[model samples]
Target: MVISSQKENDVLIKPDKVIKYKNSNIILNISNLSIGYDKKVIAENISFNLKKGELVAIVGVNGIGKSTLLRTIGGFQTKISGSIQIEGKELTTIDTLDLATKVSVVLTEPIASKNMSVKELLALGRQPYTNWLGKLSDEDIAFITKSVSLLELTPFLDKKCYELSDGQLQRVMIARALVQDTSIILLDEPTTHLDLYHKVQILKLLKSIAHKTEKTILFTSHEIELAIQLCDKMLILDGRTNPFEEPCKLIEHKNFETLFPADMISFDANSGSFKIKK
Candidate 1:
């Protein structure tokens, strides 16, 4: 069943202006963005302003440029064209270390170091703040303590990173990002390899970070329904074009089914879910 509202209001208009929280900031802005790999354009025309205190999910089916878009904004891939501004400054203008200080990324990739304990892994986040030869002061300890608490990882500090469950490992990774203390945080497929409970937990934690810390967040996830329910907004891609919008409006436009397996499944408006046909 195709999902929709009974109201006859036209489903399309200029998207609403982004809302702001008191004393919050706009941490990421991309205009006419076309991001590519090896000169092939994987995503383009992505324009949006991400306000602080907003959790944004990048939603699209596999191979629809979700990661490409993220890499471009994260400065992992160069934008073939367009402007990306982080904290009202041009993205390319920032030096590498400075850029790293501004944006922290939490990817779904497996942690590379086998020897590191959870505490040691989290210590890497302090790299930007540490002096040469890597020393941690009391302030660093305080920040790491806060991150561990936020992710509820205090008890696992001495545990080896490889020993944790997938969910716990994911939380540890996020704690590492939090210690980085960047204005913007981006994650790609953060829920991959996680169980349903862990998925919800991670999303809730990210949402809390956005609101309580007033940080701008953009994450790419395959959990379409979860994204709709939890995020303040989402960027739905068409071909290479990502149209940034709120979930309710996208539902109102009946654009939900287009994001996934075309004919076999449909969106359920009353239930606010996507379901397969019998």
Candidate 2:
């Protein structure tokens, strides 16, 4: 597959160079992936390579296994078949401790400690590197500080999680993942329960983080239009053919048109957004 950048002027004219560069930069590789419970597959034959510094989105209609795919990649659920690789190493070979250092996940699950301060919650991300007594090293402290600053959480550091708004808490959770210092970050519905402005704000922050830190940020989103505008690449999981490509290429190939039923909605390739059918 040809890897296209978001820039309209930049084009990959040489296939060989694109392949070589993609191979060297890939952070996560999924091949022939089938995800489900008890051998009942929800989706199958999924294949994609996520490169470093790319912000990708997994989008599909509800109940189409978007969360199932993310869960499988995060190693929280068992894959029915196929392989997942992180930085060229098979995911199965990586131990839990090692995996923590490679990938950080932010799920939609509610935090148990509503009274925990933002700083305390973010510091928990360093558990993989902490001593048996759960003490942070100087480096760990620095990481936490950097994460707090990166997400601009200094003002909320002392605030309890329960007191923060949904958007604020989501940023705190993302900061926690960032403090984990992983190369790949997986988030499930990061924009859930937020207003339109906050949703855009969060996605823009993620896009900036991916580009600035050279990290692969993959999240599942119901905000398809916003994702198409912000993400560098997109993975469409429509149950028939899962296609992972640059947003423009996916549109060019007419992949988005098959995403939903035609009776109510239709994809507009020119606008790169879905529209209500008249």
Candidate 3:
């Protein structure tokens, strides 16, 4: 319940001088977005911006429209109102193939092609760039190789997806997204079935990817504490007051304290943790 900014110095692939590069380009913009189905609005008046090299998390209690908002941004669902733009272009106006090139989405659903090899699954990410015969060009091969190297999937390239562990499979899925070569990546509950260790591992990998590759990574997670520690910014979907800000700023504003009922739990801002109240 308590959210605080904790810097991670142990990220892999640290650049020289550790310069905090200011990314001026907005990768994803949501303006007064109201997401829902049909005519009903689950959440309204939500606005946020994500920049390159930023990792942002969307968090809220169950049924607070986190997934709905993500789906809307990923172009999987229609927004009830407002606008979504990717790199200064309207998301709705982008063609499906073009959209695939600009944004990649990873959902909680299990991979249907379990028999597909790791390399084959990762290669599927290049479908947007492939010809009618689905042949991979040299550039496509390079992208696939880069993604595999980034995620350290070199050893398992020939292994079937069904044989990988949850964490390994998750990394493979992320690599697949990277092979798509998009500026923005959206994940819905990427830590859904992961254990605590695997959850931290996946989140750290994501943060590292965002910082190292300058990609805009946004995801919905119930692991608020982990997200606060690892993400650069956060979008808190409180249903009553949706706020997007840095974790420390949100903590200074006492946003996390109000995230849940106060009777059963209490937030310790100093330690950035929650405790049960007796």
Candidate 4:
């Protein structure tokens, strides 16, 4: 991956802060990228490179553009400027059909219908590779079966999506992404609305999937403490230099200390968690 050190007046370039990695497995590379609506920039100067088998989290306070950054990277929304390259190809140049095989996205929005069986919902992940008639090949079925087993969804395969609880449905959604078999999986708030135990369970599952399957998994999350424990790397969208590095390095640099109001909560680097001030 190329790391540009050139400085621009309008850009918040941090060549010194950015970590450099020499690996052929790098699939997703974002350099000085900006994301937002027309004429309104939500975040800028974002730079990071993700390699296969890495589970990364994008965390920040609410409205810090974590979700927007995920959408922009997944190609659901437009980027204002800079680069988003998948395997050396620009994101904008790739067409929808071809892009589907490279990146899979899971958003926080509700499904169109929960009446579909869990197995049926997972079958949709292979739609990109299916023929015009939308028939699943043996390979596709095998992929679905493998993902089901990995996510522990076998017991719920015949059950309707509506019958599953929040945690189960979330696992199903992640399983669907795994079934897609894309090189990169982008999830927006994958652990939202879950209790602490379930939240940890889901994050641990994601970390396992990424490592065992060699898929690059990136998710936006509010569970900063859990993310620090489970993620291999993290990108804090502070809207400035947007520091991206390993979890230990981020904590060593005290990035989480300034994430919120100092009067309310403070980061305890010793324990790698945020504690409310008394």
Candidate 5:
């Protein structure tokens, strides 16, 4: 999924040019993307480009189409209008098998059976490269082993997922995605059901993964303040503008001030965190 150069048609509609970050290539591109169902548009006119080695968070008020946007971009749902491209190729044009190799998605949905061991769960991520019988190849095992070490899952390898705490299970899920080894990883609320410290820990881990592996990681989260602290970039689904920019730039432009009702909570640009007016 390495894109050394962009084709003529690959230019972004908004910028009308390629987006380069820290000399990294743009891995995912969304232009004027509209996501919804039954002809009802939940979010529209959304556009952003994600570069390799970037950790991006999508934050918004409830029902602002955060998960829908993620689902649509992951190709799990239909897009009413607009384009989602990976490596300069339109998403819809890519075949299922090829797309599997390009993007890996991690939803907050519970696993079918929590009785499965951590090793068993991580093995599932290699399905894209497995043979018809689903036997593990030496190379697949090597990749899995490396991911386990990177994510520090060795101790929990034999433990059933149900035996793990919420934070541990979340780490296992992320390790599975790492095993997938896709160019882009999409997660819905990776830090859900965690305490404040764990939330910050997980987000920091994600940031580290993105920088170290150079994979584009995008996830929908409600941790706006944590995102502002740890994420390389953020996209706010504000229903109208849906602004996307770096945390500092977004704070400087006052984009976070109006995300919620002004009467109850307000964004404190100085601390880059939200505050209660009371």
Candidate 6:
């Protein structure tokens, strides 16, 4: 795959602190991406490149197509028209299983399994690498063990999935994705239906994972302030307009507050922070 990277030796460029990649870093490139359902266009002309280990937060009002964007990125939507590439390779050109091995996803909806345990749910992530019958190898077990522990789920390993709280369940889902061992992780409204505290906890957890594990994580969130505080970058959509960026340098260009909140509030450009734009 042909991933692009900014020259680290360039004194003018700030260092990218996203996750570390093996051999060399490959930035994921999404170009002219358009997505839709059977009868309607959800979004179009979307383009961006993500550096390895970067954490991106997407924000848009309800029905603004944020989740649709993540679905397109994860290959879950079939009605997309555009190109997605990782490390210089076109995403559509790769095999589905190969794609699975390269990307993992978590959705906001709770996973339902009347008979599964937390351990089993996490183990399912290794299916892409396992035998046809989904048999676990020693390597799979090792990944599962590490993932659960990272989520602090060791005490609940054998506990039934249905018995866990919403917070615990979210962690289990994340652990499942981690065990999949993919370079890109997509989460669709991960904070949905969460209490305020759990919402903060989950976003914080994602930020920590991006820093410690060096994983490329992109998730949709409605918690605007929280997302801005913890995410390395932000992708924002306003109605039928294009997606604009909130990078470290170009944040003001987005005109963030007025995009969603319809008020004449003001934001300070000096601090590189935001408030309601007046």
Against the hidden reference, what TM-scores do the models get? 0.89, 0.91, 0.90, 0.92, 0.92, 0.83
Q: Give candidate 2 misplaced runs (Cα > 4 Å).
A: 1-22
Per-residue lDDT of model 3, residues 63-92, tens digit only: 999999999988999988777878766687
Q: lDDT by residue for model 5 over 164-243, one digit each (tens)? A: 99999999999999899899999999998999989988899899999999999999999998899998899999999899
Sequence-dependent TM-score of model 1: 0.89
Query: Model 4: per-residue lDDT, tens digit, 1-278?
Result: 44445432231224344333345567888898989998799999999989888999999989989999999988888999888888767798899999999999889999999999999999999999999988999999999999999998999999999999999999999999998999999999999889999999999999999999999999999999999999999999997889999999999998999999999999999999889999
Where does model 4 exceed 4 Å of error? 1-22
Off by over 4 Å in 1: 1-24
| Candidate 5 local lDDT, residue 212 | 97
Error of 6 at 87 (Å): 3.0
Order of models, best TM-score first = 5, 4, 2, 3, 1, 6
Which candidate gets the maximum TM-score versus the true structure?
Answer: 5
lDDT of 2 by residue, 2-60 (tens): 56553332222133322233345677888778889987999998899898899999998
RMSD of 4: 5.4
lDDT of 4 at 5: 53
Q: What is the C-alpha RMSD of each candidate to the true structure, in Å?
A: 8.0, 6.0, 9.0, 5.4, 3.4, 6.6
List model 6 lDDT by residue over 120-167, tens digit each: 888889989999999999999999988877789998888998788878
| Candidate 3 residue spans exceeding 4 A from truth | 1-24
Model 1's alpha-carbon lDDT is 0.82
**What lDDT does the true structure give each of the candidates?**
0.82, 0.88, 0.87, 0.90, 0.90, 0.76
Candidate 4 positional error at 150, Å: 0.5
lDDT of 1 by residue, 1-278 (tens): 22233333221111453322222245677777877787888777889888777899998878878888888788887888877878766787889899889999987667778569999999999999999988999999999999988888988999997788888988888899889999889998899998899899999999999898887889999898899899999888777446788888878877776766767888887667988876
Ranking 1 against 4 by TM-score, winner: 4
